[model samples]
Target chain A: MKGSANRRVLPGYGLSLGYTIFYLCVIVLIPLAGIFIKTAGMGWADFWHTIWNARVIAAYKVSFLTALAAAGINAVFGLLVAWVLVRYKFPGKSFIDSLVDLPFALPTAVAGVSLTALYAQNGWIGSKLEPLGIKVAYTPLGITIALVFIGLPFVVRTVQPVLQDLEKDTEEAAVMLGAYRFRTFRKIVLPEIAPALLTGFALAFARGIGEYGSVVFISGNMPMKTEIAPLLIMTKLEQYEYAGATAIALVMLVISFIALLIINLLQARMNKRTISA
Target chain B: MAGAVTAHLSEEASVRPQHINESVLVRIVLITIALAFLTLVVIFPLLTVFIEGLKKGWDVYTASLRDADALSALKLTLIVSLIAVPLNTFFGIMAAWAITKFKFRGRNVLITLIDLPFAVSPVISGLIFVLMFGAQGFYGPWLDDHNIQIIFALPGIVLATVFVTFPFVARELIPLMESQGVQEEEAAVVLGAKGLKLFWLVTLPNIKWGLLYGIILCNARAMGEFGAVSVVSGHIRGETNTLPLHIEILYNEYQFSASFAVSSLLVLLAVLTLAVKKFVEWRGSKWQSK
Candidate 1:
């Protein structure tokens, strides 16, 4: 058996591998290369100034912080929701499960408007919230609300399968050994789900950073204030500030790329450790 | 005597720990909270917008579709997606077939690369094209030499779309193809079937649902796509504006009803896609269970 040839039935390599590289080049690589080449022409001093200007800097703070906040919120509650959907037996559980993806399929523009209408000062929930001294519609809070709306699916979807696949017997065994709920979760469950949670967080954060459609309708697009990075890039393009726009985009590209790479690596490592265990 | 009582209490506790047995009151409260979250987040905005549009009577809502700007914007969106999705589907199929049906080095890498668009925000995808084709971009001079109109036009819109949607079809098809091994193909081969006949007969039937699912998802995203399209499109009113762009224009011009009216239409389309997706997934699972 060991000596026998056991080649898989699918096609062999070489040609398809070459084609894959070529296809990726035409679609992804060349385009990124072109962006860099355009940016390369800009003097570093100007690039620094354009990207660091008050407006751009504000956009950065709004986009990065809101995205982080949104991802954090999603991580906590999204996990709870996933846990409920996976571990519970209840009526409408299936419906709640399907609803996780509703955010993914909903158009962001519609999502933005919908959120604004609900959270605007005069809007339904906003009218109620206003008397409590919490403003949402045109503030950074609005930005976070929009980010959270779009980012919800990432964490839920990422963590759900891991939760579902987690065997009940492990928890049972820990309980029999006299471990507390918190201890069992911390030692047995949290480690299993942590990497996936991190991946979801990174993805949600990346999406939050690049969100434009939802934020625009709600943010009021206030310059040096409520504007997000994506909106700023669009502004630069509209204003004929190509260098300005691409420069901002380059910074985003580097940060998001590095963040995504780390998350993906962590997910792989976690998966490997799980397999080995 | 106290030790005996304590031992009895410990024995009973060991038999069953006291738990928050989720009173009927608690369950209702929790359910209400969930419902409120859904209604506020997903349901209310959509219902309100559509209701407002129709509040002025269907006559006004009906006439919005006839607006020159709205019509042209729709026409552009339809045309661009019509071209972009099919082109992408072909690439998606080719990529999926080549990748999933093959065993090779870098296969995992290709799979990840294919999904790059999913994680890369559509806004970035749109900007990448602009960086490739904008007036001051790297390829702009070479492209401008040919007097080509790419960015800020229909071509630019299509290119941006093609990049953003590149993953959907391929992603949809992979799991379907993977779960379906080459058993049928091997059978076909043993029967001396080859080439197009083999693909059309043995392969197509097994994976048609996935292909359709991917195509529909791709189309829905393309049709409503705003962030990426906004970046690449100049939003030159009726010229480059797609349906989403048109809605923004209407909203900005203070034609609130018309914007929501158009958005109502996009929502309907999304719902249609969602239905089809459910149907396809349902169909696939049935086959699996069988």
Candidate 2:
């Protein structure tokens, strides 16, 4: 068995492996290293000065707060959408089901402009809300709406497969013990899908944090108000502040990496739990 | 007696137990909330793209699309997708083959690395290359010495698109190829099939649906890519702008009708992407059922 581990059962392994690694290095690894390599040349004071400024701090707050709100909204609605799709039958279900993926398919730039069109003061939805003294376009609220559009699919897609696999037998047994439908759902079903919901929430949050195309138009790019962390990087680059841009980008990259690592660990734990259960 | 009657009645009324059934009010409430939310978020903006695009009439819409800058942007987008998608596809196939077909050290690490681009912000995806190839970048001097331009040029756009889309095909194929196992390929090899022939006859047929699924997604992202391309593109009006960038320029210029018209085109692409995706998933499931 030990020797079998080294034995080749198929051909082209060397060719494919070499090509894959070579391509990965050229396309992804080397470019990513550029971020670190550029940032490494900066002194600690310069790096901190670039990243810890009022404008940069504001951008991070805007990025996190909007992303957090969007993900939160998505978690609730996404779970409902998944549950309704899986548990109930209705007209237009198929259409709605397909539409759930629109965010993934639609160009972020198109979504950004379309949403801006809809929520601007004289635009469709925004016209209806303006009398109430609310402004959506070119504000943080607009940014959240765009992020919501971007992140909506993440939560629903992640929760759907898990919700579908849930056993009806458990709910049936719970009901047979005289529990009501709501109680049965809360006590029996919610626990099962909790891990999936969390994963979805995290994914949506991470995506929203980095989202640029969809948020930029609606955000108005007001430096202290609606500016996002990614936009700041772009602003710096445009200003030829390569070190400053690299510093902000490096910090954002590290945070994104940490978030992704957490997600991987969470998914692994969830898979193990499912197998054991 | 009551329990038996309830059970009998429930059997006729529905397939599940009586107590598990939500009241009609609850079900209606839940479905209403879900549909309303979808309409507000997904449906309205979609409709708006078409409505505003044609707000100035068909001639205006047509003129805007036929605008030289618009056409060129469309051409550039197609060209970029044409190059980026296939290279990534080739890489995807090779990566999936290596990861799934053989037992190797660092396999998990390789897979995770493939996924790294997805986690990175699209802005950062562009910045990495700028840091590599921009005038102030590591390779800047060498490129300048050679009189070559990359960061604000076609090469940079292609590289950024490639980076952003690196994982799409591989991500789709790995789990699929893993599930299909290596037995079929091994059997084909034993029967004297080798190299390209074995892959064409055995592995390719088995993974065709998955591969198509991957390519469709990769192509969609490649063509629709905005952030990464924007960063590298100098936004030369008729020279370097892609469709999305063109739309941005038009919108920023207050050419609302024209901007929406151009967006209408990408929206059409998005719709096509979804339809093709649905068709492939249906076909893949049907093929699996066989």
Candidate 3:
């Protein structure tokens, strides 16, 4: 394969390719395979029973619903934030724009602690909210808040570039042709950026589902109430229920992959439609 | 005639199309809503970290930093990142080189496989390691006989960090190198540049900024990683605890000031990461325009 007569133009092709495959096998593939192999050892009835318990079912509901709500909230507000950053020039605009990535850079535990501090019953914002009878920390609402915090940047970052690429003249022309501001945005601008928005939503939802470090602090971690799927998996592992943990992880992984695949397909379709139109 | 013409011109001015911006009142409302959301979600939590860290006093904050456990946790984080970042950097460069420089079968499939870790939960990233090396794991008995520990130790932490951060560099480099094309490398090869010399002279300098950006993000995540590390670390005070884990210990014990102090160190790193990231983006855009 390395003979000079049949050699490719790029040098080190064999060496680099071999190292990549070998490294990937050790680093990624083999370990993931371990999950399947371990789960295979369990009886189908046991696996189903482990994953389908009432407490686990409630956890799945909380995880999916909170993640969905958070991602939906982000999809709407993230667009507004991205649009504001791109289109409007204001005092401290650059500062706020850079601040959007704070959640990405901050350690999740730190985020968890700080958010828990801020929204706890006697804490600053929490004290005020307590009077209004709106509890944030240690509730399902608190879990959603933490999810929203971590998921914000996904939507904003994904949509910002697309929004920037949208030609200003198109929006202007729509308005000039008697379209109202709302109509112009809905008909002209939204369709152009909808795919990016959907991609962002999927990314955020996937992230929220798997989120552990941040939510554990704010969620209060009561099994039937605030316990998330990842934390439940952690609990099972702590009890050395390896098979049970793997069963739950398998379900989460499959769901996330399927959701992401559907989103990718939708995005591809949207891109095709836009290009043709 | 002049008065009539002026009146018509005034009418045209009144009927002129609105700019992309909404009415001033509406724009104010939109901007305010957006800014308020950011302030609530991002800025407030950041401020809380510092304020709570200093809530006790300067001396208490200093005491937390000087605590033996905090110092050791910091050292372990540094060690873990030092190992993980360089190893991943090398892997990323190799993977990117293979994918970008060659036309191959199953290329897209390989790329997707490389990205599998990104889609995985951090908890699962750690769980897989436990499955691979835990007492009941595949090699667990063999390892137990040899007295070699991977789980509940530094090696486990490093492996988990590497798994979570596997794609950062390659993801950054693939698109960049793809856009850069292979003309330069092909030219170098034709001119008799071979092997390491070719990469050293031609490729490294070309992808330097992207590589640096990738390394910066990788290092930050490696140091700050919590969920995966937490699962495998066993939280042995100063033994396996990274900074984030240490913060969790302190916070759980209700040592609020101490936890915040340890957290302040990570906050500094986060700030530094963002600053360098911004610089890299600026430089990258400038280079592209050239």
Q: What are the per-residue Cα lDDT tens digits for candidate 3 across A28-132? A: 999999989989999999999999999999999999999999999999999999888776666887678678887888889999999999999988899999989
A80-186: candidate 2 lDDT, tens digit per residue: 99877776667887678888888987899999999999999999999999999999999999999999999888888887877777777888888779888888889
lDDT of 2 by residue, B180-244 (tens): 87777777777899899988889888888778867887888898889999999999998889999
Off by over 4 Å in 3: A1-7, A270-277, B1-18
Better candidate number, 2 or 3, judged by lDDT: 2
- All models, DockQ values? 0.36, 0.54, 0.48
Best by lDDT: 2
| Top DockQ hit | 2
TM-score of chain B of each: 0.88, 0.92, 0.92
Q: What tier of docking accuracy does candidate 1 attain? A: acceptable
Lowest summed lDDT across 10 adjacent residues in model 3 chain A is found at A1-10
The Cα error of candidate 3 at residue B223, in Å, is 0.7
Q: Is candidate 2 or candidate 3 better by TM-score?
A: 2
